[model samples]
Target: MSRIGKKPVDVPSGVTATVNGQDVNVKGPKGELAFRVHDEVVVEFKDGKVSVQPRTESKGARSKWGMSRTMVSNLVEGVTKGFEKKLEISGVGYRAAVQGKELVLALGYSHDVKYPIPEGIEIKCAKPTEILISGIDKQRVGQVAAEIREFRGPEPYKGKGVKYANEFIFRKEGKKK
Candidate 1:
């Protein structure tokens, strides 16, 4: 038996979780999220806690049993508290601004890079060099943050580029003359 799979997921107030066949729908104040659970995993709600049970002892079932439960638990937490990602601009003259529904990034490129903001995600600029991305879905929030960071990864020499707030870029010394 998987320890994580045997654990119960607590459902907070104002969040409704419904299991429909293989799909789990979670609705909360922030938004609604749906997940397609693995075939071998079965979820049940009892005494205000959700539990995941595997149908068999096969490798595939064991592998996905805990994962499925964690995914569902994350979904519930996301809708309740949401998710957030922070980015920092390092290069000089590098800045980001919101224009309508798009994010305009001037990262030393000839032309500005315009990124369309997806629905259910919110972007905020705190200070000229800091950016905050928040959403209910963890995958979507991470994808947006990665796409933004990919615009200009941290350079080795100056470490000037877009990077996560907590990310560290190792610096190397130049060759001896």
Candidate 2:
């Protein structure tokens, strides 16, 4: 009964998808990714499209059906187009840089913070205050971005810190004179 689960995910040209048991694997120009469908859901590749359906009419099965389908869709899209996250640092001395496999950050800390980049993920610093994170796995890309932002989340008073490119920070008025 899930509308999203009813629509099968399309397998675009030049991208290949395979369903083996509960495992769904997809490979495309960008990269390859795999996902294990929940046991309550059934996944199948048919006619150049991947389909997901609930294994039973149980409430739990239905609840996971749509989510499983979306997960599969994300895998296909990830391998084909990949995913990216952009972070911007704002402050007098806040900056970021990538050297070798590590990201060096200066968030007004007493010492520079060094974060080791994970495999299969790429980090780039076009500008000292801009950080670009890209990878085939959507979850990992987001996790990295979040971790970086966690180092110095924007403060309401000064609105200075690392934050997402499109994020809006709520400003707080200073003490009245």
Candidate 3:
């Protein structure tokens, strides 16, 4: 039995959860999110909580039970509290700015890199070198942060480039003269 799958996901006050067939939808102050569970798992919303159980005594069904529960939990939390990611730009000329709906980046490149911001996600430049990404969907926030960091990933030599605020970069020694 999956330990996490056994615990029920509580639906807080002011938040609503509805389960229709294999589809589960959660609505909260932040936003509304929906998830479709696999046929092997049964989802229930009762007594202000959501629960997931396996439909059969099979390995695949058991495996899907825990994942389905987690997905439901994430949906509820996402629509309630939402998600956020922070990025830090390091380097002599590395900087970022929000120009209208575009994120203009200067990562020592000859031409400036312009990234178009997508819908439902908000990008803010707290400073020229600091960026904040926020959205109701956790996966989309993380994906946007990763794509921004990919523009100029941290280098080992000087530890310069864009990276997560809490990320640790291993340093490397330079060649001897």
User: Worst lDDT window (10 residues) for model 2?
Assistant: 73-82
lDDT of 1: 0.91
* Candidate 1 lDDT by residue in tens digits, 1-177: 789998878989899988877898899999899999989988877677778889899999999999999999999999899999999998889999988999999999999999999998999886768889999999999999999999998888899999998999998887899
- Model 1 segments beyond 4 Å from truth? none
Root-mean-square deviation of each candidate, in angstroms?
A: 1.1, 0.9, 1.1
At residue 95, candidate 3 shows an lDDT of 93
Per-residue lDDT tens digits of candidate 3, residues 1-177? 999999999999999999999999899999999888999999988999999999998999999999999888888889888989999999998899999999999999999999999999999998999999999988899999999999999999999999999999999999999
TM-score of candidate 1 on Cα atoms, chains taken together: 0.96
Model 3's lDDT to the true fold?
Answer: 0.94
Instruction: Flag the better candidate by lDDT, 1 or 2.
Output: 2
Give the 10-residue window scoring lowest on summed lDDT in candidate 3.
71-80
CA-lDDT, candidates in order:
0.91, 0.95, 0.94
Give one clash count per candidate, in the order shown: 0, 0, 0
Model 2: colliding residue pairs: none
Clashing pairs in 1: none
- In candidate 3, stretches whose alpha carbon ends up further than 4 angstroms from where it belongs are none
Candidate 1 deviation (Cα RMSD)? 1.1
